[model samples]
Target: MPENMPGRINPEHITIVLNQPRYPENIGSGARAMRNMGFYNLIVVDPENFDLEKVEKLSTHAARDVVEKIQIFDNLQKALSPFNYVVGTTARLGGQRQVNSPSVMAEKLIPISKENNIAIVFGREDRGLSNEDIRLCHGLVNIPTADFSSLNLAQAVMVICYELFNAGTKKKHDFNPRLASCYELNGMYKDLKDVLIKISYINPENPDYWMNYIRKFFTRMNLRAREVGIIRGLIRQVNWYGQKMYKDGLDHKKNQEADL
Candidate 1:
């Protein structure tokens, strides 16, 4: 193993997540890549074909430790719930998909990885992460490629892991404090969405489209747990006040009818 870096990032705090992978060999190779880069934490969500024998064959005896400790999840949301920071990998880019190069993303994660549990998520081989899947991520990373733009699953993992490993070898710096977990952030978003819908601030039929902007705005803030709690409390108060005013209006209408 190479000498440990003096940076703030703790390899143990960083996790590599594979979402709906189709092949066990890819999974094995991905694990091997992670092991080569000094990362051992691995999580797979809803794999289509998970043959341990094939996986072990590709991963070999060297990465046996990572393969043995792999964590499996039925859904992406559950897989990400415990993380404080989530970075999604994508090939396709367009509206709402703000992507950073692998090196830039790794540098951004250096400080955040000190106190937060970080998850680097890679999508399926055939199709990368969907719009909905991207919504769960705080940021996106794209590995620069030739015109082809497509990379093998393990290749992508290796590219990202290498960037992270290389970045961690730099000098240490002041680390960022602990941030809000996905569970807390998701709950706050749900409450805020409900309040916005109730007050007609967002279109109820297509609220997600509007909420996407809201999500991006808050994601930039890098909110802490206390900040999330404060926001949720405000949302609850707004919901209560809206309901009270509606009830008062109905009572006034009833009184007018009885007097008539």
Candidate 2:
């Protein structure tokens, strides 16, 4: 097995969006968390202080890559438009929009991200993302905390990235940064969805409901790309064998009829 980070595989594509961030140290700390959790992409959108040195200091040695490669964007939309899915992290809740717990949100994102470039946008430290900002996101990610919950910017990033990292492994040297791409997992889902549709287990039109359930169910399994490929290949083989059996049965029946 590969050296495990958080999810065993680094997320193929993930962008952390910080809008009007106040502190440089938080940025550094967040970057550090990203490196530790096997992430490299960091974006700062119109922050108060864009100090690379501060970020480097807070990021420590592990997160140097993230800080070095940081992308600066003029606004949130510009940063997020490229990604297919976005998850916003915030502390506030109770509005027209429904928010999910971090655990639930993480599971929901795992498979989707496997098939899409996923972005997690965080708002300002003092106030968190605005309602309009939250609306831009596909879903909300709320870390579990007390009634009066408060989390530092870096801490929040740490929590979310840690969720993606699979069980930590002791064999540090075997670590490979390559994660399953969105295309690969997309194919797996398509394969699984096809089987389910053919088996008449799912209503083809309203597959999202079932798919969401299945996505969460399978995400917890900590599946990797190679494992997904194995399953996909097996499914195809099973389908092929089933077709062969049916063809053979038809030929045998015709032969008997001719003899008769």
Candidate 3:
């Protein structure tokens, strides 16, 4: 940990999202945990008959403001729309999911939170994140346990928040980079896919197969806004040139027809 960067990220920049939380007590305690670690923003998505009184009671005055100001959303995607970097927490994980421990994630998150809105999403009490829900997130976080891996909703929240707070308190470098937002990245990828399709670089029937690979490639780069803009510009140029060549070939064909 370097010492140059102090107070790099504010608590306001980080949001804790509980998706379809079954118990108000859990939500309350989760808020309490966040408050303990200096985080305020809380978003509840499709909660199950949550009781404000229960929340307030369990929060124990620590997170009264958080409980009162909690944002509610019907859809997970809409709930996460405002955030540029979204990380989903999961107990069971496999496949293409890249799950990082809380400590590792905390280090990566600190710098990004300084420049963009960050959301750390916790799933339901019964089951963890669905495949669809996980897909929306930019990354995954997993809390390691001994034999019994399953953790209570609030407990999981506390572990991750604690790591983030601990990481923030430590010495850090002045690593403020102008990274592209998720919205901008999505737009750039769309344009890239279009250009790739136009040039027959990717199969039209399953462009996402190639696009997912490309997305993974870019995610590692932590691409800056200017880098994304340059890539988009390059795609546009390629598309323009491809269109020109096609039009020129058509003109040549018409000329041959006229000569004959």
User: At residue 154, what lDDT does model 2 achieve?
Assistant: 87
Name the lDDT of candidate 3.
Answer: 0.86
Q: After superposition on all CA atoms, what RMSD does each candidate show versus the true structure?
A: 2.6, 10.3, 3.0
Best by TM-score: 1
How much is 75 displaced in model 3, in angstroms?
3.2
Clashes of 2: 6
lDDT of 3 at 220: 80
Clash totals for all models, in order? 0, 6, 0
lDDT of 3 by residue, 69-123 (tens): 8999998978876577889999886788789999989888877877778889999
Regarding TM-score, does 1 or 3 come out ahead? 1
Q: What is the TM-score of each candidate against the true structure?
A: 0.94, 0.60, 0.84
lDDT of 1 by residue, 124-230 (tens): 99998988999999999999888798899999999999999888545556648899999999999999999999999999999999999999999999999999999
Please report, as a residue range, the 10-residue window in candidate 1 with the lowest summed lDDT.
1-10
- Which scores higher on lDDT, 1 or 2? 1
Residue 88, model 3: lDDT of 94
Which ten residues in a row are the worst by lDDT in model 2?
Answer: 169-178
User: Measured by C-alpha RMSD in angstroms, how accurate is candidate 2?
Assistant: 10.3
List clashing residue pairs in candidate 1.
none
